[model samples]
Target chain A: MPLSSSHRVSRRNLLKGAVALSALFAAPLIVSAPAAASAAAEQYVASIGKSILVVAGGSQGQMSGKFRNLMARHAAISAIGVFSLGKYRSKLPGSQKSEYYSLIEKFVAGLFVKYAPQFAGNRIEITGSKARSARDVIVSSKVHFASGKAPLEVQWRLLKAGSGFKIFDVRVLGVWLAIQQRTEFTSVIKRNKGDFGALLKFLRSK
Target chain B: MGVLFIDMVGMRDKGVTGLSRLLAAFCIVAATAIFIAPPSTLADGNRIVIQPVSDDGLDEIEEPGLDDPFEGVNRVIFALNDTVDQIVLRPVALVYRTVLPRPLRKGVANFLNHARTPVTLANDILQGDMKRAETTMVRFFLNTVAGFGGLRDIAGEAGWEYHSEDFGQTLATYGVPSGPYIVAPILGPSTPRHLVGRAVDILANPWTWILWDATTLESISPTLGETISARDDALETLDATREGSPDYYVTIKSLYRQNRESEVNNGAVLEEELPDIPDVR
Candidate 1:
């Protein structure tokens, strides 16, 4: 090892070249393997329907808890993005804004609990799925009520999150849920003279 | 009658013979010109014939924006309607849905739709659609005769389609612009043109005229029943929309505008081509 400096330098260069060549050959395989894995593991629109059925199966209080958990896991980003807090976004202090958002989540969860029971004992069949964009999918389903009434059409809008998809909105009978909430909330804010505090109070009260 | 028929036949022979002679002369002249054309000129004509036609002028023109001058006032009225729906209509519809059997509710809806046959027929005629008017008359007759006054839709079962038309659609077809979107109290969405159309339609409605001399309750019962049936049918959809929309007013406004536009265009617009107006919140 101590023989000649030139010999040692050439030997080090050879080792480095060998390592670089191996990395070049292995890089594409490493990248391709994960892409294939993710494609296989990607969540589908039907998964949201299955999750909703589970949440809808329970009692109101239990359903609320389950729905809240489901929302926390899937809808948190979409809720914040779509609710359109408007002036309240800047007017509300950070802590209060966070509180407002949390209250809204609970209120929405309560709404699901209130409505989901009506659909209990019903079969939710996923009919089809449509891709709205690279990141969004609309899953169509039919709710066959236990009373043998006409089936209701339901479409769940899902947004890609990480390797899976999360429900962002639901259209039942062609009416969108989030849009209605926005209208209601905006009306409340306007009535309260554009006071964020009042809006927060309203959410808290609910 | 015999003399008139003979005169009509004589007129037709004179007109047809004259038209045939004129067409024959035009064809002969055109053939002579084509045969006498030079080779270079003919090749140039062939080039023109083989050239691809430009479609720039034929592209679909985007529809103009709707008149919404009363948007502020309309929004207030919309809120009122929403409150009314939540407090009164929704609860009543929920009760109706829970209490009535599905088949009975369907029968009520069928009867209500059947009763409105005259309204649809009048609108069809006003829109100058004789085919649809005839279809409406036939459906009404068939349903009334075989379906026990439309408690059952026998014609519908037999594959005769039912269509709903209103004077508003007729007015639209006749170039009446929808003058300003307005959220009318009690009636919900309307425009000046539509409001006028509604008035005319109510006057023209045979059911209303028939029940005019009856008690107030008897006159209003059909309207009340239809409203309740429609609300009950839309319950899940309405509630779901309320739940899913970030700004209900904006979404609803857009949806209503799109619906009305489609109606006015006789559903010629492709769904994918519809603009998704974003919430203004």
Candidate 2:
């Protein structure tokens, strides 16, 4: 599903209170990009995640290499985040054997090239971000998609990472595509007698 | 603190207590009047209820006019509804349709057709049997998953079965008159009674039941997302159809009545009586 489809598929205020805490956690952050640029990058990555999930389900056609790169760029951030916050057991670490993770990497890398212009600008908007709990944060960003219509909603959840946070899950629309994929993967694996290789091949095949 | 607490206590005796007594007296009088009200008078008021029907035969009613004034409205609504459906839903359907890869779509549609026969059979088998309801419930769930979960493949193969029976139809089945036809903004062609029926079905759909079963945010997302997407698609079609007609209401009403009539009666089809397309070549 395209990230647009993710919005089609399915709140928070950390405010004056977070100013102190944000200052406390600020310096180690490697994001040299302005907050707006960083938000645009984040949105792109979330979109790529949605695209990979949609394509993996065998619901979409062979995307152009250009499109694939665009998807890869956006997806890379969270893929790395997943490995960084590596409590969850996933084949994402073994990208060589796991074609799923490999394709996902390509998907996000592709996205960065296509959305680089949007990222270059400092005018991106990130508004109404709030911490659901100490561990979970919901941030809603407004970014322009292809149509140049009103800004679309791209939201993500970041889980605690020692002092900072890592992207744990992102919801497009309301459906957590990652969770959905996981659920479907579990059922498919059980039904197929643990042959994830066959399932992956089938998913990746034309 | 002591002075404030004592002052609060003093005010409660004079104001809150007195108000509570007055409200209590009003409630007692209201309750007595309600109890004294005549059952016949209550029955005579405008209350809509589904009447029991014999299983042997369904009630028959006059067919809707093909050239009814509201035809324009019906067609417009359906067209707009179809537009939205095609735009939003077609993408999803196209994806699923590719995966299932028919001949399967037709095959699935056929399977559902045969499956429906048993619903009537069960109605007969149980002889208005509640036990049969259990079998029907099981069958309905299994088929719904197969039909909906596998929508494109199943529906494509099976052909569309507009099996939606609303409260209006239920009322009509039980000999209740269809009150004036009204066009709901996003809901499309509906009579006053059918509108009520739509409301009831919206609440009663299995999706809502599932939400009740698992009231987590996770469970709620997919169902709500799908519903809104589907509804948007349907409305999109209605909007397109409305744009085509000079008189939207006439076109929609005509189409709705014709569609409903066709549904009710297994009769010969009539040529569409609407005006020529203005823009399309």
Candidate 3:
């Protein structure tokens, strides 16, 4: 009745394969269908918009923690940090990787705190939503200002994170934040003769 | 009046006719191409379907890169254009933004948008986007009748947003290659295909015929107003972008590539390389 060593190894491999296949089949449950994702993305957008307005009005240092937590929970900062390097992704010096990530974290958090009031105070309206992929949803919204200035159009690109989703990138005023920075950082690196530290230096300057 | 008429007559000499008209049209477009440029995204937003163009899958669609083959000449023109923008356009736009009441500025933008509804409708029909064409017609009716000559965008308020459409995009839909980028004099970014498309849209504009200023053999253009409105609207964001950029030229080039590609695809999600971008509940 006892199996040989080879038979046991093959059995383990087959079980592992079955488990992996089942997980693959279950992947759709995260986002499920396009319609479901759209509704969930809309709700997520609404909640975030509400909180940002409530918490964003305070001083920079006062709101930094709240924003940091919000950002950490909601944004794909690591992915964005890597993406921001553009063609210079591999050129990132290993020793400075942690420093780069920390600096980028602060930079993004700082930007979040600064631009929140600009985009939030007027009025937040969920205009539309689209499924970029099964798990990636782009929810479009408008921050309409009471001042009659043009509304800020934001397309929040989200991917399924944990049980829900996280903000991957944002397109505001016809520019993607990550993409815009990609060009900037790459240019800095190039201007410095492909020294990755130059990018770090540039971010530090900012 | 007499001189313009004489010029018009002189323009008719054999093969030179098309060239002169093209020159005149090009001059007009160098003004209005601001309206057609890829970044002319004044829409509330558009929901476009992801339809397959060729037999190949969506993955086969190559990424549209910044094909700036004319980088050398483009930089020269872009520099010259930047200078003009700084010394002239930016200041004018700033003043326009500052002096004009918000309501009046809104009306100006709405009016300009309203004026182009017919042209958009025409392009929608040309591109065989019946669904979009239908929405265009509805928005036009609502904006013209209810919004009062399209000065309010009542249609947009009613959830029917007006998206920009043109022959350029139509040509793109049918798989035409838009040649190299050129920063047109005082007009910003363009390409050869776009130049041709602009000419067609210029002709498509009913005003090009309705309000023909025979003296100049050109359309009575609201393009100057359009340029100012666009500049005023984008003023703050552009200033920030310029200040932060190590190279504004490359920044703009990247933005243009993204903008044009997104517009051409009508904001459909065929998915990007990073398969699963996170989302929130």
The candidate, 2 or 3, that scores higher on TM-score is 3
- DockQ of structure 2: 0.01
C-alpha DockQ for predicted model 1: 0.04
lDDT (10s digit) by residue, model 3, range A1-206: 89988677687799999999999988887556887888999999888876766677666677867877777777777677766765456666668877887788777666666565556565688988988666678888887766654565778888776669777778764556776677677778878877888777767876
| Deviation from native of the Cα of residue B141 in model 1, angstroms | 8.6
lDDT of 1 by residue, A12-74 (tens): 799998999999999987666444433422335456566777779866658888888888887
Candidate 3 chain B lowest-lDDT run of ten: B7-16
Query: What does DockQ give for each predicted structure?
Result: 0.04, 0.01, 0.18
Off by over 4 Å in 3: A1-43, A53-69, A109-118, A121-153, A159-165, B1-64, B214-221, B272-281
Q: Which stretches of candidate 2 lie over 4 Å from their true place?
A: A1-98, A106-124, A132-136, A144-151, A159-168, B1-281
Question: For candidate 1, lDDT tens digit of each residue in B1-281?
Answer: 11111111110000011223234334433433333323322221111111222233322222223345567887888888778778888888889989999889988978978987878888888888999898888889999999999998888667566667777678778775555555665556655555555555566666655675667577667666766777776676567656655456655654555456555554342325422322222
- A best-first ranking of the candidates according to their TM-score comes to 3, 1, 2
Instruction: Score chain B of candidate 2 by TM-score.
Output: 0.40
Task: List TM-score per model, in order.
Answer: 0.56, 0.28, 0.73
Candidate 1 regions exceeding 4 Å error are A1-43, A76-83, A86-97, A117-121, A127-129, A191-194, B1-106, B117-149, B152-185, B200-206, B209-218, B228-281
Best by lDDT: 3
Model 2 residue A42 lDDT score: 50
